[model samples]
Target: MTLFKVLSYGKGFKGQAIWASVCSIVNKLFDIAPEILIGIAIDVVINQEDSFVANLGVVDPKEQLYLLGFLTFLIWAGESIFQYLYMKNWRELAQKIQHRFRVDCYGHIQQMDMRFFEDQSTGRLTSILNDDVNQLERFLNIGANDILQVVTSVVAVGAVFFLISTKLALLAFSPIPVIILGAFYFQRKAEPRYAEVREKAGQIASAINTNIAGVATIKSFTKERHEKKRISAISDEYVMANESAIKISSAFTPVIRMAILTGFLATFIVGGLDTLNGDLAVGAYGVLVFLTQRLLWPFRDLANTMDLYERGMASARRILGLLDEPIHIKDHAQAENIDLSGNIEMEDVTFKYESQTSAALKQINLTIKAGETHAFVGQTGSGKSTVIKLLMRYYHAQQGQVKMDGVLIENINIVSLRSQIGLVSQATFLFNASIFDNIQYGNEQATEAEVLKAAKLAEAHEFIVKLDQGYQTTVGESGVKLSGGQIQRIALARALLKNPPILILDEATSAVDNETEAAIQRSLKKIADGRTIILIAHRLSTVVHADQIHVLENGEFIESGSHETLLKNQGRYHQLWSIQTGGV
Candidate 1:
């Protein structure tokens, strides 16, 4: 859908838009009146005794001139006032639309299934949120107002021309059809070129984002030169795409200028000849000449306008495409509420990532009673994290139901279901914010004392206290200011502060040093005392004390027993332990 049409659905802005458009059109009409006035002034100066105003009603030339001055002041004032009004309305509307669209897009992204994120890269998503949204904003800020004024200029000038001199006006307006047709042709051709430019820009954004995010990896591998060449290639493609569109757009104004000059010259030569032949008045000839420029000069701006529209339309398509993404996994209307007591069950579960893919999980069945601690140990690509993701309702198993306290998870409202579960993953992400803010992010209502308590439990408080500003210290982008162990601890503290009845720590201690891991283990033991804990870890030491351990491989649970019992079985878990710890 077009931006205006998409935005028109907002009943709240309809009246404002109408008022703004009315003011805008009226302002342009008044703006065109000055050229008409200039023609009338010439009429009065050259034919004072028999001017149109004197012949009509005001026979006194001095009174007529004063009346003209009054009208001139009114016209100028009206143009200035409405100019301000339209600008204010257009800019404010642009801001509001941008804000609303960005929020809606972000909210939709949040609701999307984890599989969507797993398959997509962070850099690409960043391009959509930042670059795509700004493109729409830039269009609305300027293009909408330009189009309105163009339409107003055409209609208002055409009406005045028809009233003043039909034949001469017709001659002057002759080139309009040709100009408009040419504009449409250029618009059609330039649109695809601009779309390519926008796509290339998105790729550029993705490449830069990926490189910055993986700077450490590039440096470690001594691949900066290779990375630079890759980035340069993408950047060059972006520049070339823009240049292709620019070449076409630059040609537009010159061609339009030549067409507009044809009409201007027609008015100048024909109208002057008519005046000399006494077929038209001098002032009338002047009006036709001056109005010709007023009518056609704005088309010069069409190059800029068309350029803006193409960029906006290209960006709009991408933004709207994101908005149009179907919510395939919808919440049930009559969904039940999940109890705080976390009695969870997965029954005969099976799931596939997409329609064409084989099941990620098959015939999975398990149960965890309230306040029990369970763990899963597995190799890479074993679908261990996938289980936690399922529990979090990121994806629904097609074949079987997942239950929380006898209420099917699909039946529970997603918000409430999530509120009761706290998850800490191996890749712990911390926002660029104060240490205190990051810790309190999960539980915004948490008191400072409560935040400190959680931080202390996760062994994050000690390092935080040692920082220059203690809890108030800023964590650089993605917690780059802190070490991996520190970021993990802070993330753990954030989850701890949430104090959910159900906690899922998916390899939460995998990145930390042994000393930090021991501290986290102590914290985990204390926290797991009264909560339902599902620990998914490749680190065997972390889950050794769990009440039960499930060894998963290729999405299936191959062994289930106490940690010691699994070790005694001499199976996959035992083999993993031996390989990892050099113990038999």
Candidate 2:
């Protein structure tokens, strides 16, 4: 059933699958011909001028032997040719399917909502994409062909046995039902075990990924040995899971072999007795003995084939299940691109995280006009960053409307809407690439001159040029090579390069020193001519010159005014400002 599901999912490759299967069956047909040829050669030697070959008009014994040798050459050559064809077709098909599945799965993951990622681990997803997808590819490349050939061998050889003698044919196939029942039993027992093995594999992958990502923390805490033991514990669990599956699968082969041995011995002893009594031809008995091994030997490989099938199907289920995860945040059906002027409004908006009991933002109403500078100053968990997330449409508000320029945010094409806003968050992420590439990532089509200009505006150019490689320098993963201040400045420059109508600095200057922060503030002033700027910061000094500041406490604005007006009111904003300025 899982095989059929996988095949249905990849129906575009049906032609290649059929071609590979045909080649496998044909090669198997040629593979069995040698035994029949050996039987014919024995007949020729035993019957001489009255041989089956002579009956075909050869008459001479030597010429009959020569004809048989020629047929042997052709059969071997045909077998080799079809073997190559099937291998090439099957392997190539495997590569194509693997490539398509990985690409499509990754693309689907990119489109998933933020909540989906909250529930899944990066390591588990990576295992599905890399290990699980490759598992299926392995089955397609080898196991599929093996299955086809085994069936072909049984059907072709069985037909020959029945044509020669019914009673012996019946006896030869008697153990077949037993083998079938054993295979079914093993498959049923192994399915869940292999599924658990795959799950354990994912868990170990997650553990390793987590440890590697947090190696710095572990080292700082002097817990290297502890982490190692933790990972070893996970690995041991994985081994145990695999051992459980292996025990079930391993028992299959011996059971099948015993059944096959019964069938082989029955044909050998009975057919030999029949030949001696003159009831069966000596040549026919020889064919039956040789063909019985050919018919039954492949069943021994059934255990290994089923092992691959169960593992592959388990991985297939995980991969397909990930692909089926719903995309909760989707653009409206009739959504169209719009040229926004950055007029944002959240009218009585309420939002709660799926895992949380309390609302993050509660019936909040706010508005920011085009080309205006506004700042949200709040304590931790006061929903400053939540506002930015809603504005970017990363998460939809559970109630009320978020609109941009009078149009509901969901009604606008998501990509077009996000493209018009440049965001530099507190936690900056940079790829492991040259500094110039990281800055240019904001707008891929940005010119080198434009990137340099944005870097200058963010006050990162002076420090960057002082470095050994300057803009060409490689920043390690997540900009680990740079200091926090430097990384934050580069993130700002990247956003500046986008030159969007709205620029959001969500605690963007939190990592910089006072001097660097002052320089960035001056740069922001110069660039604040025709763009909307939303600043979320704890540093009251940085937002002193903003056109307006809203003080939020527990997801509601308790005070809203210009810096001087809020200070004059002597409310929560005045208390925060006084504490920071040491005037409390």
Best of the candidates, lDDT: 2
- The lowest-lDDT stretch of 10 consecutive residues in candidate 2 is 1-10
Q: What would the per-residue lDDT of candidate 2 be over residues 72-91, giving only the tens digit for each residue?
A: 99999999999999999999
* Native-referenced Cα lDDT, model 2: 0.91
lDDT score at residue 199, model 1, on the 0-100 scale: 82
Error of 2 at 83 (Å): 1.3
Error of 1 at 417 (Å): 0.9
List ranges where model 2 is wrong by over 4 Å: none
Number of colliding residue pairs in model 2: 0
Misplaced by over 4 Å in model 1 are 1-4, 7-11, 355-357
Pairs in clash, predicted candidate 1 = 336-411
Cα-based RMSD of candidate 2: 1.4
Pick the TM-score winner: 2
Whole-model lDDT, model 1 = 0.85
lDDT of 1 by residue, 1-584 (tens): 47565566345677777877888888888889989988888888888879988888887778778878999999999999999998888788777877877888899988877667766677667777888778878878788888888888888888877887788788888888888888889988898898888788888888888889889999999999999999899989989999999988898889989989998888889888888999899988888788888888888898898889888888778777777777756677897665679899999998777744667787899999988999988888777887887898888888888999888888888888898898889888888999999999989999999999999989888889999999999999999999888988899899999889998898888878998788889888778778999998878899889899998888899999997898799998889989999875
